[model samples]
Target: MDREQHVHTIDTPKARIQAPAFACDSHIHIYDRRFAASPGNGAHIVDRATVEDYRRVQERTGTQRTVIVTPRPYGTDNCVTVDAIRQLGIDNARGVAVLRPDVSDTELDMLDRGGIRGIRFTLYTPHQAVVTFDMVEPLARRIAELGWHVQLHWTADQIVEHEALLTRLPCKMVFDHLARLPPPVGTSHPAYGVVRRLAASGRVWVKLSGAYLDSQVGLAGGYADLAETTRAWAALLPQRTVWGSDWPHVTETHKPDTAAIFDLLGTWVEDEAARKRILVDNPAELYGFAR
Candidate 1:
């Protein structure tokens, strides 16, 4: 989509429930205008999602902190996300960056100083090359030295195939969008079993976000089963599970309604204690959110 087409102001719904202090939106993208001029192949251009925009969402949603994730459009140039963290102030935010395997230690140190806590490798989109097992080892070692985690976006089906490699990584592994599992199949699906087992490892964490992307029934029915699946995963690893809005919902023709996404969490984890862990405690611990 063109940058202009993605720039329209969206009316975010008022959060229906009060969010706890230290609450965090662990995943969102901030595209800058410069990325469009210097785009990568198959890149999806988007309007700049500035720090001001995030502040407004936080004000409305009671989100006290956020994790700015670098989008593919930026193509490993994490300037947009890094700049947003600096502009927003590091005390209230952290970031996940996209970096080439060969990025120097100096650059990685600079990123850590800029509030980056993780390195994300994408495997969901065909446009982005699939990351291999070989890549995982060295990358994991480097990130582990920095005390940063590795955030992976992959299809559920690929988990079993890559299980041994992923399990052996020295760094903490975060699975985005509940391992990007396909919905309508429910938690009983074999792939989710792999997710459960992965979570049981203590080193693997899962984001209870992006159900709309994986579900077959749009937002409504899609979220119900997705919540069921999340509950199962949460039961397996409550301390390791976290939640995020996946705000802006890029690429989808109809953007995911933000309020609807947050409200769905209530259904996913009905127990207040579990919800607290996913929304507050877990993120604070995983992302190293300063109290």
Candidate 2:
């Protein structure tokens, strides 16, 4: 396939806003045209989202720093994400990567030098690329040796079932998308209880991004409930929680409005002091973002 000939037209929502100076889009993905190549072999072929694509969105959204997460379509490849960090420069970027059990220490050190601070395990996809409990222990130990965290993308149910193995890890754990919790609009959900316990562990951090993925209220109503749930989680462990935009809303029928997404974050951290902590202080400390 001709990579240059296939230009992706991104239909971003038209909500405008002044970008916040200290604000960071904590979660994003970048696909390179060369390495990740065509979205062939059962991979979903979306337009290549390069560092340049992200820079454009950051300019419009006023996002100062970003966390480039390794996406599923790319499988365990970290080349695209690593290149993005190098091109964007470390002062403005960090990354989460995927790895196989056999990944060498030398390779991990190289990634660390390239601005990768975390590793991710996807537990919710049909791809079934879920990391086993056995994999978590040793992998967590290695990541701990590198001073990085493990980002878990599991459904709320899995989180509950895997509590023992997850908490046993030596490294820090970051739960993506409100820990993939069930929408708070329902009955006594196990996810909420699990999240509460995980937050109390002091080693776990949750990203208040991707609420749109779990909410039933589309964008408007969905975000409100998400904000409320996030607020509750933050209250449990204000210092351990952070915010992210989950930009580019890949594979979704309705893309999220980036501007409004940031605005909604304000609702999650209502108190002025707490808002500063979650949006600025906490993320800076967790990801080692340069001041």
Candidate 3:
């Protein structure tokens, strides 16, 4: 079988939903321990999981393109993320890095040529993070000229407190894990309104991934607790949402069922064209992937 046409899944009955042509997993992490982890950033170390492993995930998920996020374990050292983009073929992969605000323009140019499309700050689980929240604006200003975005994984309350800072950043913003909103009051959360206002400005993209992240009801119910927030985002920002598997799931003690998580899109949007918007079109536009 031709490599690009390859389709495989980890499920016993096999995943019935295949991703559309050019569909992209807009967030993932590739860990290569051959490159040493930065000091105090070792909690996320998963042994030897590289691009080859992720390609199998792509096969399982039926996705052709992906965006590699610099995992928290690597801190500001983007080498692992950069190398994954090269290995996965830059045309089919892009990266979101973690960088210090003092990163030189030389290094910045190097990253741009290296297929990096954005930067991420993992404030949700902050511990020895090299970049602080205060550094966001300056770095946001720097990357804005490069057309790169600032991706955030802040908690809902953090979003509420940082409203002034969140609303005025110079570049585009991509929030992770359904904006980390708490359940039951999912869309009604104050942070959701802040995000909605931000989205209304046409500069925000939210990952329709990580259904298990904030679900009080847990995955056995197919993350039904997330349904309200998922549908609300789909209704409001179909053009701005993208999907991710959070592959390897280093943060979780139990791995999520990837096929089942991907299947959540079916629940989120029954309309296939809208699903394609999250799976294909929006990512191609956000990450500069060729359609």
Candidate 4:
């Protein structure tokens, strides 16, 4: 393998919006070269963004808690994520791991001790994925006993197609990037209705992250379309919504100002109480952070 190139920097302004006490970022990844990417995995480690690197993001955005997610590059090997959770300390951090159904209970117990609260199904893979749709239900059933949820990264159409499956999960569910809705159609897309329905189910949480990825207008335009979608989703399910920085902005052509993204939440949820619900209260409930 060749030397990996670094991705975006953590260059961001001091967040203008002051985060409430125990504010959680709720989504992030710490990619280390020590945990090599799977040979078959399409997503490679373009950077060595560590737990320390992401603390800079947290500092810039005034987020005190974080959810460390296992990136697709490492496939089902969750060592990087687990190590990060350990490094960040379980008291202020939780994690989502990419694991298969065959993982032993003992390993899961260790992961739980390391602050893992969910399993991620990276279904949007260009190549063969380690964890597939067929694996979700069985794994969900197993992790449900451990009180873990299923975190899914699916496109809007796939979310619609698997709505029943998502609803049937024994544990709670999280939809990444607000189902990665089509930028052109925004909430008008048929899948947006399905996502709303899922949110209404009270078992699903939509991550108000990744505005940079979902924006059709590019990063320079400040992801106006995504901001609109966030406002709509927040109005419909304030309790079910949580925000993330998606720090290091992997695979993105242009890196967004994370502080700007944090401030955008203030615009979406104008009321201070409602903003607290989205940023502090909701994440506390979802990730088991102390209230």
Clashes (backbone N, CA, C under 3 Å), per candidate, total 0, 0, 0, 0
Candidate 2's residue-wise lDDT over 107-144, tens digit each?
99999999999999877763556355457678888889
Would you estimate the TM-scores of all the predictions? 0.90, 0.87, 0.93, 0.92
Q: Which stretches of candidate 3 lie over 4 Å from their true place?
A: 1-13
RMSD of each: 3.1, 4.2, 3.8, 3.5
Candidate that scores best on TM-score? 3
- Backbone clashes in model 4, listed as residue pairs: none
> Model 1, residue 237: displacement in angstroms?
1.5
lDDT of 3 at 67: 92
- Error at 260, model 2, angstroms: 1.6
lDDT score at residue 14, model 3, on the 0-100 scale? 32
Please estimate how well model 1 matches the true structure, expressed as its whole-model Cα lDDT. 0.77
Candidate 1 runs further than 4 Å off: 1-12, 34-38, 130-133, 220-222
lDDT of 3 by residue, 58-115 (tens): 6667888999998877878999998998898999999999998789999999999999
Q: Order the candidates by TM-score, highest first — what do you get?
A: 3, 4, 1, 2
Clashes counted in candidate 1 amount to 0
